[model samples]
Target chain A: MDDARRGAIEDFLRAASGDPALRITGAALLSGGAIQQNWALDVVLHGAPEAWVLRTDNAATLAVSLPRAAEYALLRAARAADVTVPEPLFLCKDPAIAGAPFFVMRRVAGIAAGHRVVKSATLGGGRDALARALGQELARIHSIKPPRADLGFLGAAPADAGLAFITAQRAALDRQSRPRPALEWGLRHMERTAPSPVPTRLTHNDFRTGNIMVDEAGITAVLDWEFAGWGDPAADLGWLCARCWRFGNVAQEAGGIGPREALYAGYGDVDDARVRWWELGAHIRWATIAIDQAERHISGVETSLELALTGHMVPELELQVLRMVETAHA
Target chain B: MHEPPDAANLLETARALLLAELLPALPEAQKMNARMIANAIAIAARAARDNSTFPTPPEADLIRAGAYDPGTPGHDAAVAMLMDIARARCAVSSPRALDD
Candidate 1:
């Protein structure tokens, strides 16, 4: 952050907090969130040190993501639903303060790296505990239903979440220059065996391990609300159990942290079939996202080798989906 | 025959040098980028060695239209063909994926 912007942010915080002497002690851009930039902030509020995160938009962002204000509303709703999330403080819509709209929230402490989280023996207390905690967190997230004015931006609940996802993925595939037969096969299988329409609830579209903050005791907070929407609650569980999110620890199943039963044990009784269906959807969604990321590079929107490499992940996801369909329990 | 040090071999040699000499000297922040570059080079080398191309299969539209649903005519055959294609792509893009 530049001195001028830092001074502007300090003035904004001072006005918002009603503390004349409030000062920003430190500010540093955090790594991660390809679509968003989070700046770790140290503030002196009321003569005490406060750790907070200022979240703002990146130079390039996916069209599907919610804006900062919408995300702030989501955090409030999730917090009200008893879901563990950072406490949203203030939202600055005026771009002059930081050259872009941003929001401030209390920074929760935990290690969130997917590879390290999956490989660690002690993080999240134990694998089982972490899995259960994740399940419980998801259950809390699902507890939030639609018809909420604050969450009205999510639009009406899908009549059939399965069909909605299938339609979306098909559209995404159609947008690609190359035809993906494997993804098509998976979509066809899903269409043939899609479960009956279920009541839609708030689904964290990206509730995998890496999105959560975890310490030795357990989960400290759930991160990333940009993709939350009214959909099948099982979608969250499926996303958690998706093979790609497991970071190569495929045997564990539940975010590569623990068994499915352990995760389910924390949440209430869940239909296994629905979770399986959404798990397939999760793979399709991930593959689509990878393609989209690569498109950003190919289209000359944002050129980066990371995005280019991500496109190569499509075949592996396709293979996973194919194997799942073939080995699906009768 | 052209030569022993072909494009694929040359790429492999360059990658080996990068890992041996350049990777260790890079800063921590740039290491991941270097590794990704190395991985991209490795993938390119494999692709050059294979010298294969994957055209979109005719079954894509059929599968999208649900002709590949279970018990449908040619469903199994189409699915098998897709699996073969996926495996072949993985061979060049990510061979370890096949093992998994």
Candidate 2:
């Protein structure tokens, strides 16, 4: 952490926690998410303070996450409507408070198994049920209506969001020194017959199995609201069931365990044309993110084995993009 | 029914992925992906052994799921195009598919 940023965060934490004597004792990075940094922060309060999680925008960040303030509002909105989410305790947008924007939220505890949840014995017999539950939760999220102010902040819709995504990605990848035949082909496919125009909605751009917290009962909360925005809701569904997000079980396409039936069944009417369009859009989106990630790795943006692996998924996802496009037209 | 892949053929495919695909990119950090690709290939080989008759990977999913119209004249052509990429990168091979 930058020392100045650290001090600002310290001051913000002291004031936000309502404990002047509270000071950060320990901080360690958590696993699972990379875009928004989750620092397991331990604070000793003067009176009484619980273990709190600090989510901040790292200097090195991905484009997908919602801006900190936006995410805070999103969490507040979801929480009010009975959607389980990390309680948005305080949002600090003042750069004076944190190096960059950050938020303090009630830490939720549970396993969000990216790789094992698909066929886990813990989820025994509950596979279909859990899938249905996830769908319902997503439905609730999609049902939300943001105020004109929030919608304005979220920005205007791209005429062809999918094509816009493809063009942006092409521009970024064209600068790279690599063989990107698969990406090129996928982009062409997306461009040839783009997703049809559809009504955009409040979408959790990263809603998927891996991003959800599940326990014995079922999905507890959806994490990673950074990607939340106003877009095609089908993009969310397609992203959830996308080939890459399924982790180990590609066979279980419905967010790894359930079929699209349960998900769409809950999503209701699913707006097939829109969903198919967004499905194609989501592929382009993921592939673009992947290529950018790969570029990051190759450029030494964030040097980690994991980052390199993320970069490699670009080709695989491009293939999926083609599949989604073909799936749309087929 | 799935056709059983010959053990030797599976091994050969594994070798090719390891050597042609993974080995060349043996930069220190690339091992994770190299291994993942290797593992995915192994699992795919196991699946292949059980059923050598690979379903068209992106087949029926597109048509049935509204990915495209099966009745479209060029649908088969599209499938063939997708298969070419799959055969090259995904290491899927068929004996009797003379056209592909």
Candidate 3:
């Protein structure tokens, strides 16, 4: 950040914190969020050091992501529900502070890298325990239901989550420049077998492994509430079990952490059938998202090798979707 | 006729050199990028050798138009066509993802 921006942020922190003597010791941009930028801020208040993460939007962001203020509210709600999340400290709406709306939250330490977390034998209680903990964490998130005035931005919970998602996917497909036949087939299959509405609950729509922060003990916090909304609880379960999210640890299907039984055990009791159905939904969702990410690269909106390669992942995702559908039919 | 070291063979040689020489010398951060470059080169070499355009078959168009919803005639054929398309894509992108 520039000197002026840092001074503005320090001023905001002083006012928000109600500590006139607060000073920013250091500020550095942290990497990894393609949609949002995270700045690691070191502050000293009355000689006590503190670490905070300032989250703000980049020039271009995913259309589905919630605004930073909305995301702050989500973090607050998630924290209130005893979901492991960084404690949201304050919100900065005035763009003068950082040239964009942002929020500050207490930084939590953990390894959130997908490949490393999945492969590590030492971290997160060696898979089974971590899986169970994740399951329990998801259940707590689902405990927060819709019609919550605070989460009004999420609108009303869809009467049928499956159909609602399929509609959204189809609309996304329509926006694409070219027809994706494999994705279209998957959507059609999903539409044909759309499930009845389960009880609507607050769903962390992106509750896969990569979105979680894991320490040696277990999950320290569930990160990225930008895609959260009211939807079928099973969608989270399916997303966790999706093959694409498994990071090559295909046998340990529960986010490549542990088996489905362990995950279910953590959730207390869940209908396995519904979760399986949403697993199919997860594959379709991922395929569409992969295409969208690729389009961002291809259209010159954003140019990154990662996004370009993500487009290449569609074939595998398509194959998974087809295999799952065939298995369901059989 | 082209030289003995054909395009595919030349790519293979370059990839071998990249992995053998440049990869070890790269920093930890650049290693992943180097590997991705190598993989891209391999895929490109494979595509060159295959020489097929990898077109989406006509049945996919029928499928996209909803001519093969479940229980409809040609649904199985449509599914077969889609599987073929997916398989072809995997052949270029990640052949190991395909079923045995």
Candidate 4:
């Protein structure tokens, strides 16, 4: 950040916090958000040191992700529902303050990397506790249903979540340059075996290991509300258990952290069939996303080796989708 | 007609060199990028060696039309054929995925 922007943010914080004496001791960019920018801020508040994270839009935004202001409101709603999330402090809509609209929130400490989180047995107080805690957190998020005035931007809850997902995935696939036959088969299978309609609930659409923060005690916060919206509550369950998110720990079906029963034990009373149906959809969802990420590089919109390799991940995901459909038939 | 060290051979040798020498010398942050490059090179090498051109049929249309729905006349046959194609692609793209 430049000095001018830094000064503008400092002034905004001073007024927002009602602490004229507050001063920013340090500011550094936090890594790992390719589509967004998160800056770690160290400030002395009330004569004590405090750490906060400032989230802002990147140069470009994905079509489906929520804006900064909506994300701030989501954090507040999740907090109100007792879902573990960083406390949203303030939102600055003025682009002049930071070159884009931004929001600040309390920073929670933990490892959010998928590989490290799945490998470390010490983190999240062992696998069972972590998985169960995640299930409980998801249930709390689902408790925030639609018809909410604050979450009006999410539009109406889909009458049939299964069909809605299939339609969305098909549309995304159509936009791609290549025809994914395996993905098409998977979608067709999902369409034929669509699950019965369930109540619409707020879903943390990207709820998985890499998106959640885990400490030794347990989950500290669930991060990444960009893809969140009202959909099948079990979609979160399926997303958590998706084979791709297992990070090679395929034995542990629940986020590569613990058994499915343990996670269900935390959430209380979930239909296994519904979860399996959504799990199938999750594979298709991830495969489509991987292709899109790769397209960002292939189309020269933004080039990165990581994005290029992500394109390669589709075959594996496709294989899984085929296998899963086979097993479902059996 | 091609040279002795063909495109696939050159890619394989370059990948081996990257792992054996350049990878160790790279900084921690750049090492991940190096690994990704090596992975991409391996995939490219495999693709270069595989000459089979598997043209994908308009199965999406058929599938969407419910032509291959379960219990239909060609349902099982269509699925088995699709699985074969999926395996063939994985063989060149990610053979590890076909392990199970």
Candidate 5:
């Protein structure tokens, strides 16, 4: 933490809390989130101590990500809907305050590493219950529909969300310098079998095991709302069940936490066919994103070993996509 | 000409030394990066040993152009070609993922 940024945060905290004596004890950067940066802050207001997290954009970010204000509003909406999200407190739009736009939210505790989360039998009420809780939490997130003034920036819900995704992916493929015949073929299959769009709802576009926070009791919070938008609810469900997101626990389909049935049971219903379709789409989406991450490293935009290795994951994801599409046709 | 130690052998020896000597000496924070370095070395060694080229099958362009339906002759062939390519990729990236 630099002096100028610390002074700005103190000023902002004083204003937000209306406490002239409020002081920040410490602030440390937290790990994870390749696209965003999170800072853990310790603060004392009128002798009452609290911990908060400051989330802001990194200098380099993905092309399709939402702005900080949008993400703040989404977090507020999710919290209001009884979803287990960190309570968003204040949004600081002035880049001078933190070198970028940012928001402060109450911090929650949990480990979210995919490898540990999948292997641990002691965290979050174990695998089956945790999977169910996630399903139920996703249901609550989906309950938040559009037509709100705050989330208006998300744009109108597409008439056919699946087809819209396919089209966007195809456009992305076109933008790539190298040809991707497998991806193109997968896109064609998706176009041919695109399901009729159901009623659109708020979807957490990146809901998976690693994005979720869990402790001994259960899920502490669902993190990462930057990709949340109005789309097919089934997209979230399928994304949760996608094999790539399973994180090596191939048998436990629901984010490598539990079976598909357990997840659907928590969600209160199951649309097996639609969920399967979106699972196929998930693989395609992941493959494209992996390539993008690799390009980010390769092109000198943001050089990172993790990003480069993520690019290597494309083949495994593509294989999954191919196998699923084959089974779908059969 | 280069001496008896080939590129693959050199990479393997370097990787062995890295894992056995330098990796354990690394702090906890740097362990993951050390492991990734070793993994990269292993991938390079495997790629060097298996030097077969993976050319995109001729049917790939036709598939991309929407020339064949699911049951058609070229369609299955294209899928097979893609599967083979995927397998080759897995051989270098994560051979274990293909084991199951």
Candidate 6:
């Protein structure tokens, strides 16, 4: 913690909750999220010695629309309505807080790893129950109505979010990026048969199995709201079921836990046409991210083994889009 | 108590080719795919072998940290352990992906 940032934390704490003597006791780095860094902060002092988590963007190479303060506000708002989330304390926009901006949320313990709970027969319930719960939670999140002013921040509803996403990806690719035939095909197909009408709502953009914390009993908390924005709720649902998010049970579409029906049931409606369109769109969105990931290797990032494999998923997703498009035509 | 179908065998074979045949032909720079392909093969093999088996303590031991890393592949045993664990978890692959 730098001098200016530490002082900012103190100031924000005092202003938010009217406490001045809060002291930072301990802190340790936690891992897993690719785009950001989270620190397990053990804060203790006068008043309530609250435990907190400090999150900051990890030296980003790509630009994004959401900001830390925005994430903090989203977390705060979500927590108030009983959405399972890390209780946010304060957000620091000051760049001096260990480089990029950071936000503090009260820490809670539960496994956020998909592999951990899904494999544990005791925890996983041997059924698709958890995936159903995730669907329900997502529906609850989409239930919230953000202000009209906030809609612009989100850009647009779910219908064409996929198109906007494809445009962004194609622009990135056209800039001397690596040529991926699979991505091209998926984009063209999506363009040819873009879903009709738009369904917009607040979306937890990265709501996959790994992002949520689960215990033996049920879901403990939802983490990582950085990608949270106003968009199609079903887009997030399809993202939850995207093959890229499925670590093992490729056949089990609901975050690799169960089928789409179970997920749909959890969402409180099985026949919502909006979700199906987003489902195909989600596949295209994932393919775009995957193709760009492959290009990142060419773009000279860390070039990890998994990143390259992730890049290869574009063709697979393109095939999925093609299949869905053909199925739609049929 | 049952083995995965021939599909996993095919996946295992494809994964092997990705690592053994395709990976070796590439330069050090392109070796980023070596560990993932290797881990994918390892997991597919385990998943194929135990697709029908109930969740056992021994089967829960196959996550490979090395496969998760970019530069250094963790020990093969860890990878095997993760692969084994993935057999039970429908998330039988890398739960988290490395940046592409």
Give the Cα lDDT of each candidate.
Answer: 0.90, 0.66, 0.86, 0.89, 0.87, 0.64
Q: How do the candidates rank by lDDT, highest first? A: 1, 4, 5, 3, 2, 6
CA deviation > 4 Å runs, candidate 4: B1-4
- Encode model 4's per-residue lDDT on B31-56: one tens digit a residue: 97898899999999999999776655
Q: Which candidate leads the pack in DockQ?
A: 1
> Which of candidates 3 and 6 reaches a greater DockQ?
3
lDDT-wise, the better of 1 and 5 is 1
- Tens digits of per-residue lDDT for model 3, A284-319: 888888898888889999997778888888888888
lDDT of 1 at A198: 87
Cα deviation of A17 in candidate 3 (Å)? 1.2
lDDT of 1 at B23: 98
For candidate 6, write residues A1-330 as lDDT tens digits: 555666666666566555576666666778635567787777665655677788887665345536777788778777765688878877778776457888888888778777665555455444467777877788888877755453345554544565665576567546534444334444554555555545667888888878888777777788877777766566788778776677666677788767777788888854455566667767766766666666667667756556666655554555555456546655
The sequence of per-residue lDDT tens digits that candidate 2 reaches over residues A52-112 is 6788776778765568888888888888777778888888887666667778887777778
Per-prediction DockQ: 0.78, 0.06, 0.55, 0.65, 0.59, 0.05
DockQ of 1: 0.78
TM-score of each: 0.96, 0.71, 0.94, 0.96, 0.96, 0.69
DockQ leaderboard ranking: 1, 4, 5, 3, 2, 6
How well is each residue in A77-111 modelled by candidate 4, as lDDT tens digits? 99999999999999999998999999999989998
Which residue runs does candidate 2 get wrong by more than 4 Å?
Answer: A1-8, A23-26, A44-46, A94-98, A158-196, A322-330, B1-86, B90-100
Q: Chain A alone, TM-score for each of the models?
A: 0.98, 0.84, 0.97, 0.98, 0.98, 0.84
Per-residue error (Å), model 5, residue A7: 2.0
Residue B9, model 6: Cα distance from true site in angstroms: 22
True contacts kept of each: 0.84, 0.00, 0.53, 0.59, 0.51, 0.06
Alpha-carbon interface RMSD of model 3? 2.1
Candidate 2 docking quality: incorrect, acceptable, medium or high: incorrect
Which residue segments of model 3 deviate by more than 4 Å?
B1-11, B53-66
Better of 3 and 4 by DockQ: 4
lDDT of 3 by residue, B1-100 (tens): 9868888889989999999999999999889899888887877777767754565544434655678887888778777877887888788888889754
